[model samples]
Target: MDMGGLQIEQDGQTLRILLSGVWGLPSAAGLDRRIAAIHAGGVRHAVIDTSGLERLDTAGAVLLHRLWRRLAAQGAKVEWPAPRPEYRTLFDYVADSGEGKVIRPPKESGALALVAWVGWLTLFFLREARRFIAFIGRVAESAAKVALQPRRLRLTSMVHHMEEAGLRAIPIVGLLSFLIGVVMAYQGADQLRRFGAEIFVVDLIGISVLRELGVLLTAILIAGRSGSAFTAQIGTMKVNEEIAAMRILGLDPVEILVLPRMFALILTMPLLTFYADIMGLFGGAIMAWSSLNIDLNLFAQRLQDAVSLKTFFVGLVKAPVFAALIGMVGCYEGLRVKQDAASVGRLTTRSVVQSIFLVIVVDALFSIMFSIMGI
Candidate 1:
C-alpha cells in the first residue's frame, strides 16, 4: 500500500502530501497512521503531489478517491497537484469510469476503418446493380429481336397475360386507390375547415391523384405481382429445360418466351394507371358528399378544373417507364434463374424487390425532370 512511500507534512498547520510513486495495500496501516497524524495536527487543507508518481492501478485510484471524498465530508479541502503530461490520459480514464487508473492518452488510428467499411458496402451494391443492369440489357435485346419478327411472338399467350395483368388487377387497384383518395380528402378537409378552405380539398385530391399517387400505387402493385410472376415463369422454364431446348434448337428464347410477357405488361400498365385515376377521383367525391356537404356533381366539376388533360398525360408518361422497369426486372430475373425450383423462387423475390426499388428511383427522376421543365 505504501510502495510509493506516501509522506504527509505541514506548512502553517495545513496538511500537504507528496506521492512519490505507486502505492498499495501492504502499507495501508502506515498510510492510515500518516493521515491520522496530519489530522490530529489540525491541518485541514490537503494537497496530493503526484509529480513523482509513476503508476497507479484501479485499486489505488479507488483508494485515493474514497480518502479524498471521506476527508471532504469531514470539511477538509482537497487538491491534486499537476504531474507529467502523460498523466493527463490517466486522469481522463479516471474521470470516465472512476475505476481511477489514470491512463495515458491513446494514439489515433488513421480513418482506415471507416473508409474500409464504406468501400465494402459500395462494392457490394455496385456488383448487384451491375448484375441487374446486365439482365435488363439481355431482356431489352431479346424483346427487340422478337418484336422485329412478329412470327416469334405468341399472340395467344400475350393476350392471356394482358387480361391477367390489366383486367384481373383492376378491382384491387381501384379499391386501394379509391380508399386512399377518400382518406386524403377527409384529412385535408378537416385541416382546411379551420380556414374555410374546404373547397381546396377537391384541388388537392385531383392534382395529387393525376400527377403522383395513381401512378406510384399502380407501379408498386405491378412490381409485386408481375415482377415476381416473370421471375417465377422464367425460372420455371429454366428448371424445365425449356429455355435450354429453345436455345439448342437455334431459337432465340427471348423472342418466343420473354418478349411477350414484357410487351404485355408495358401495354397494360398505363391503362391501369388511367383507370386508377378515375376510381380515386370517384372516391374523393364520396368523401366530399359525406363530410363536407358538397354534392358529387360539384366535386366532379371542381376536380375537372384542377386535373387537366396535361396532368393526366404527365402521369401517363410515367406509366411506360414504370412498366418497362417492372417488366425488365421480371424478365431479367426469369432469365438469371439457376436450374432449380428453389433458385426460381429466390430470383423471383429478388427481381420484385429490385423492380420496386428501381420504380421509385425512376419516379423520383421523373419528378425532378418535370420540376426542371417547370411542368
Candidate 2:
C-alpha cells in the first residue's frame, strides 16, 4: 500500500491537490519535493483536498499550512475542501499557533543589562545562604537528637562514610602534602642562602606547614574528592525518587543520609590533619637534610624550637569546621538536585566549588581570629 503521496493537477487558473495515505515525519521529505515542484509551476489559486488522506498528523498539517501561506503570499487564494473535522482542527491549530514565526531576542543596553545581572546574582546568593543556614539548623537538631539517644545514631553508616571519605583519602592527601613540603623547603633554602640564613629555612618549613598548609590543603582535597562524591550520590538518589520514597516510608533523609556523613567527616578530619602535618614535616625534613646541609637531627631541633603547641592546635582546630562545611555543602547541593541526570552533574560540580570557596573563607577568618588572640 502507498504510505503517503501528494498529487497536483491544474486546470486553467485553479490548482487541485490530493493528499493520500499517512502524512508524517517519515513522509515529509517526499512531500517537500512535491511542494517545491508545485511552487515552481506558479499556480495562482489552489485547493487542497484532504478527504483522500488516510492519516494526518501535526507534521503533515504543518507542511500543508506552509503551502497555504506561500500561496496566499504570492497573490493566490488557497482553499481546503471539506475534510474530516479532526484533520481540519489539527490543521487550523498548527497554522494559527504561530509555530513558524522567527523569535528575535530583545535588545538591551550593556550597562543596564550588567546592573540587572548583578542584582539577580545578589538575590540568588542571599536566597542560597538562607536555605543553607536552614539546612544546617535541621542537621544540627537531628545530630542533637542522635547524641541524646545514641542508639538512634546510624553507627554502621557513619563508619562506612568514614572509611570512604577519610581512610580512602589518606594516600592522595599524604602525597600532596609531602610534595608541597618539599617544594616549600627547597624554595625557602634558596631564598635564605643569599642572606646566610639557610638554617632558618627549617623554621619557615615547620611554621608554615604546621600552621597553615597542612590542614588547609587537606581540607581542599577532601572538599573536591569526598564532597563531590556525596553530592553525586545523593543527587542520583534524588533523581531516582529514592528520597521521596524514603519520606513516604516515614524516614527522615537528613538523619539517615546527611547526619551520618557529617559526623564521619567531623570525626576523621582532625586525625587526617594530624597525619598530614606529620607527612609534610617528614617531607620538608628530607629536603632540608639533602639540600641545605641540615641533617635530620638539626632539622628536628629547629622544628621543635620554631613550632609551638599553639601553632599545631591552631591548624587542628580548623579541621572539624572545614569538614562540617564540606559535608553540609555537599549534601545540601545533592538534595537540591532536580529530577534529571544533567542536574546531578551540575550540582555535584557546584558542591565541590562552593565547598572549597567556603573552606578558604573560613580559614582566612580563623587566621584573623588567631592573630588577634595572639595564638
Candidate 3:
C-alpha cells in the first residue's frame, strides 16, 4: 500500500479497492482523479478495504464517503469490510454528517422584503434615539446632583481626565492649527498677489481661522483622540463587569465615570480653542512675512483693522457645545457595548465617528444661527 494512493482490482462483477497510508489534508491531493477512475471502471459492486490505512483523518473519510455515495448512486453496491474501529467511526461520522451535501437555492426577494427591511431599520433608529435621549437626561440629572452636592463631585478624577484629554492634546492641536494657518496664508498670498492685495492675506487667515477652521478642526481631532479613548475605557469596564459592580455597590456609573469626562471637556475645550487660534495666527504671521513679503507689524496692523473680537468670540463659543456632544456620544457608545471584545472595538469606532459627525452638525447650526443674527 502506498501513502494516499489507492489500488483497485476487478474480478468478474466485483471490485476490490485498497486504501492505504496517510489520507489527511496534506496527503489527499489528486483524490478526485482516483474517485473518477473508480467511477469509470463500470463495476457493479465494490469492497473498500481500509486494513492498510496507516492514518485516516476527516478529509480522507470525506473522500471515501463521496466515493461510496457516487457508487451507490450509480446502481453499484459498496461495502466496507471489517474496518478498524477508528476507521469505521470516522467513515460513519463523515457519511452521516453528509459532507459535500447538496446546497439549496436561496429564495427570491421582491418589493415586500424591501419594505420590511426599511420598516425594521426605521424602528431600530427610533429605539436607538429614545435610548440616547434617556441617557442624556440621566447625564443631566447626574450633573445637577453633582452641582447641588459638591462633595459628590470627583474633583481628582475630573482633573486627571482634563489633563489626559486637554493638556496632552495641546501639542498636536497647536501643530495642526499652525500648519493649516501656514497653508491658508500661502494660498491667500498667491491669490491676492494677483490683484496686488497681498496684505489682505492677514485678514483672510485671521478671519477664517478665528471664525471657523480653528475650533472645528480642534473638535474633530478631539473626537478621534479623546472621544475614542472614553469609549474604549468605559467599554472595557463594561466588558469586565466593573460597571455592574458599581451599581451593586449603590454607586452611579454615570455620575462616577461619565460626569467627570463631560465636565472636564466642557471646561477645557474653550481654552484649547483659544490656544489654537493664537497658534494659527502666529503661523499665518510667519507665512505672511516670508511668502507675501508683508512685515510682521504690517500683518498685525492689518489683522487688527480687519478682524474683530466678535470673530474670535464666535469660534470659542462653539467649543463647549462641541465638547459636550463629543463626551455624550463617547460615553453613550461605551455604555452600549455588549459583553464581548468585538463589541468594544465596534462601539469605540462608532463613538469617534458619531462624535465627529455631531460636532460638525452643531458647528453648521451655529454658523446658520450667527448668519441669521448678522454676526
Model 3 lDDT per residue over 115-175, tens place: 9999999999799889989999999999999999999999999999999999999999999
Candidate 3: list runs displaced more than 4 Å: 1-71, 74-124
lDDT of 1 by residue, 1-375 (tens): 337566666787566777765655565556556554445244578787877676765545555665565566667688877656645565556556855356677854568767887899999999978987786777778667666876767899889888877888999999999998999889999999999989999999998999999999999998898788888888898999999999899987777766677778889999999999988888988998899988988897887787788898989899988988888788877888886788987888888888889988998999999999989
User: Which lDDT values do the candidates have, in the order given?
Assistant: 0.80, 0.91, 0.90
TM-score of candidate 2 to 2 decimals: 0.78
TM-score of each: 0.68, 0.78, 0.73
lDDT by residue (313-372, candidate 2, tens digit) is: 999999999999999999999999998999999999999999989999999999999889
Steric clashes per prediction: 7, 0, 0
Judge candidate 2 at residue 141 and give its lDDT: 93
Candidate 3 lDDT for residue 151: 99
Which 10-residue span in candidate 2 carries the lowest summed lDDT?
34-43
Model 1 scores a TM of 0.68
Best by TM-score: 2
Which RMSD does model 2 reach against the true structure? 7.0
- Which one wins by TM-score: 1 or 3? 3
